[model samples]
Target: MYEHLEYYGVSKKVIEAMNKIDRKLFVPPEYQDSAYVDTPLPIGYGQTISAPHMVGLMCEYLELREGNKVLEVGTGSGYNAAVMSLLVGPTGKIYTVEVVKPLYDRAKKIIQQLGLENVEVFLSDGKFGLEEFAPYDKITVTCYAKEIPPALIEQLSDGGILLIPVGDEYVQILKRIRKHGTKIAEESLGHVRFVPMV
Candidate 1:
């Protein structure tokens, strides 16, 4: 998995986290053999565990630290949250939300099984953001949307980083948004396709 992400220019920290987190744990039983293949695999409910390279790229963009509090929208298979938990280490916290109940249950169980104590998975409308845990140091949205949800921006801490895909339903641009006080800076990472944010 680490070797496949090399071409994406992922940072050393993200690479280390990806290396430590087990992708097979988050994949469906039938897809277990393909878990380390670096591509996205179906996880039911019209959702997918993002490709390893994409995950690495998003993590690189976030620039996570050991003490940072992170928010993840669209938990899917919970693979991304697991890797992020590794990146943030034990001192940090990760709150991941999945709109689909079944997915949320599965992800929550798997995360617990893996003993990632600092990560929490919840079932809710991810677009609304988790207000109780506002001011996250980093936020990552796995799904695509026509626009950046205002709630997510407001939830980000000052000087925080947000990585999301925004555009039409069919196509979207992976963007990086940095918050400085009340101002924001946006940069398009690349064109990509992802399931629409529900």
Candidate 2:
């Protein structure tokens, strides 16, 4: 799996983080064999865990450092958050939110069982961006949004980076937004399909 991700240009650091977390643990029992196949898998509640490559791309593009604080808008299966936890290391913190109660509970339990102490899962509408932990150094949204949520942009710290997919439900363009003081810059990472943000 690491080699597959590396071939697609996932950075060495991100790949290492991916390797530490067992994708199988995040997958539903019926789909265990497909866990490392680099495709999205349904995790119930009409939500899907993101493809491995997408997670890698987002983490690499965000330029996560050992101590950077990260906010992930959709918790899904907790797979992406698990990878981010390793990328951020012990000193860093990860605050992830999921709108669905079942997903939130499952993800939080799995994260705790894995002993990823730096990750905190919250049950809330991801669109709101978890304001109490505002000023995140990096923010990642796992679901597709009609437009970039204004609240997320406001919560980003100066010089922070945010990665999200934005467009209609069928397809969307992955975007990278960089915050610099009062200025903001945007770039397209290419097209992708993800479940709606809701």
- Over 38-61, each residue of candidate 2 has an lDDT whose tens digit, in order, gives 789999989998889988988888
- Note the Cα lDDT for every prediction shown: 0.92, 0.93
Q: How far off is model 1, as Cα RMSD?
A: 1.1
The true-versus-predicted C-alpha distance at residue 28 of model 2, in Å, is 0.7
In candidate 1, position 42 carries an lDDT of 96
Residue by residue across 2-97, what tens digits does model 1's lDDT show? 875677798777888888888998899999999999789999999999999889988888898898899999999999999999889899999999
How many residue pairs collide in each prediction? 0, 0
* The best candidate in terms of lDDT: 2
Q: How displaced is residue 93 in candidate 1, in Å?
A: 0.6
Error of 1 at 66 (Å): 1.1
